[model samples]
Target: MDTKTVTDHLYYPVSAQKMDRGEGVYLYDSGGNRYLDCASATFNLSLGYSHPAVIAAMKDQLDRVVHLTSSYQSDPINGLVQRLVETSPANLTRVHPKVSGGSSANEGAVKMAQHATGKTEVITLFRSHVGQTMMMASMSGNAFRREPFPLLYPGSMQVPDPYCFRCFYGQSKETCGLMCVDRIDDFIEYASSGRVAAVMIEPISGNGGNIVPPDGYMQKLRAFCDEQDIALIFDEIQTGIGRTGHMFAAQHFDVEPDAITTAKGLGGSGAQVAAILTNERLSGLPAHHHSFTYGSNLLAAAAANVTLDIVRQPEFLANVRHTGDYILERLRDMQLRYPAIGDVRGVGLMIGFEMCEPDGKPAVKLTNHLASAAMEHGLILRTSRYGYGNVLKIRPPLILTMTQAEEICDKLENLFMAELAR
Candidate 1:
């Protein structure tokens, strides 16, 4: 049951050890090794593992039905769709469900945007990662993923994300004047050429190390997209469904995107479900152009409906905000003590720390070592992929308590100290 044995035998060895089960914010290996899951199973599982309510909902729905094609409207699917329409921003009413995952939802969004606008070009941030699909992979900025699949989908362009930590433009966060948004303006001016239909972005970059843009940046970009008659798409795969102390990260900035794609936490650990929320304007597009066979399956819809009901509550979100603030404060204190900690960023429960060498270069090797060490010590973390993999992502489940947060922070602090001493 050692890590070595597990990795050697597992089919796809992404983990140090094979997980036997999970409950709340913890994952246990068959050997009874417990790990505090700060990774949140790749930033999904927002409500954590095996919530009683989510399990009950799934079980109850299983008794009634499992899969129902979108061609026929089932009660669970219809009811869930209606709830999504009602809860989303007024302008965004039309709902398109996809099999649970970020990539499919993004694919749906791209098709909708193109269908609505009759344009081919899609622009996104340079460090952004949409998904692994042929089209989504083309839109992603990760070179490693796209390198193998050469000749990815055409009509995709990359613009600089507003990464204040390592600003594409040489400007500080305080005095930069939100040049990141202005770069989008530049892209619209020179690159758009009336061919660009959509500008997709993460309200907060997820796998790109939870990089949060400055206040007003998202709003300004939304305004720019509106003025240019381009559809604004929010890929909230990691930031939606109350991961960021809000139902959607766009809500935090008060920016209503033309379309928003969400997955991960949509099923509340019950079923696989993802959805694309768009306005009537985009939905009015011919249906034949954009359709999925099993998007609104009955079981997925029921699970999603229950998940949304729990996440959308004002009191629950307020708790998230409160817990997030406490975690951020502790991280800031850690940053002061560790020179390797270059930056601490993100909103709500989605947070990260960028590790750097003493010379200020990205300490990728050290970060990987630290993560391995942390896992050995019963904590799980993630590395980012924005040029360097030194950024440590700390996106735990929303159901995590302050006590759990404290334990995580304390363990991380100990890890940092131990590594530095070594």
Candidate 2:
């Protein structure tokens, strides 16, 4: 490797090229090689790199202030919060800027839920990737990731996700009648002390192969949580910020959650920041209950403010929907040409298509090969398959144009026909 790495990251700058910089939906290396950013630069570059407006905003804020703890108020933070609240679902009236990414926000959300409900347990899906922290890693549905940690979080409970492709109930969606949702009570009663503080779910399981549940899945889960009086927390770190053609994925199902944790794209600038958006009812945490030193960094908040302004516009969201539809349609067409493409799923730009064997099992080897090969062809896609390794994640920047979508499709078509057809 030409560059020094500090962490065990699997994706990004994979090639032995000292990446120079990025612009729009593209990344450039020191060798001047440009690549189409198909994975949105690890699914966080919502505006893509060097977005002029975001850069200008961050620069302007840097002149006024660099950062402040959450205890102090700053204009950038206030503005970002206002924009988030205004653009969020009607029920998400309050927002708390957390001092960490998805995992921290999730942990904070859980604490708030526990505080409000007086319960310590939470119910999470079997495939939902929460975060990298121990508590989150333990709470995650990915058994392979959690297997090493024997002393995992005790209060977290697991339930089958609404994964229709491999439905846990072993029945078709038409006949199963959402047996996944119907079993929550059984799990709660049989698995826990009958006291779950909250139920956290990813509206579209991003790392779990872009698993978009059936139409009524979110609504059904919402009803169940309401009946059970458990806080419904939607982890929108991957699907939020116009990536889903909506401000939030919950809007797609027309179901509002009790809270939503956002990050990844929220910062807009390459800096990391996250927040826990909740309804007013769940905002009773005592002062200093939770805090991160840099959670409310002024620069990140400035970038996020600019990002929200640009992404929340009706025109911007419409473009995301249109471009996503174009890409999805092309991918579906590819499914007919390639037997490897077992499933084409997702909404907006947050998309994935599983590579599969002839017998319909996940083609993990081929999927991994194709993802690596994509870089050789001047494109960057993500194989964010959790442990399954068959889900080739295709989430691109929200700014992707029709031409870029077609180019990606064309590159993929060629990759499949020329390389994988062997």
> Worst ten-residue run, lDDT, model 1?
284-293
Candidate 1 lDDT over 326-407, as tens digits, reads: 8899989988988788988878998888888898888999888888889877899888883367888888888888899899
Point out the worst 10-residue segment of candidate 2 by lDDT: 1-10
Which portions of model 2 miss their true places by more than 4 Å?
1-15
Clash pairs, candidate 2, are none
How accurate locally, in lDDT, is each candidate? 0.83, 0.86
Question: How many clashes in each candidate?
Answer: 1, 0
Top candidate (TM-score) = 2
Candidate 2 residue-wise lDDT, 1-422, digit = tens = 52355323656544555688899998998888899988887799998888899999888988988877677778988997899899889999888885668888988888899999999898999888888888888788767887777787789978998989988889898888888999999999898998899999999988888888997888898999989999999999999988999999988889889899999998775767789899987899974887888788888888999899999999999989999999899999989988888889989998899888899988888888888788888888788654366898888788888899899899898788877778
Stretches off by above 4 angstroms in model 1 are 1-11, 189-193, 386-388
Query: Candidate 1 versus the native: TM-score?
Result: 0.94
Would you estimate the TM-scores of all the predictions?
Answer: 0.94, 0.95
Candidate 1: pairs in clash:
100-273
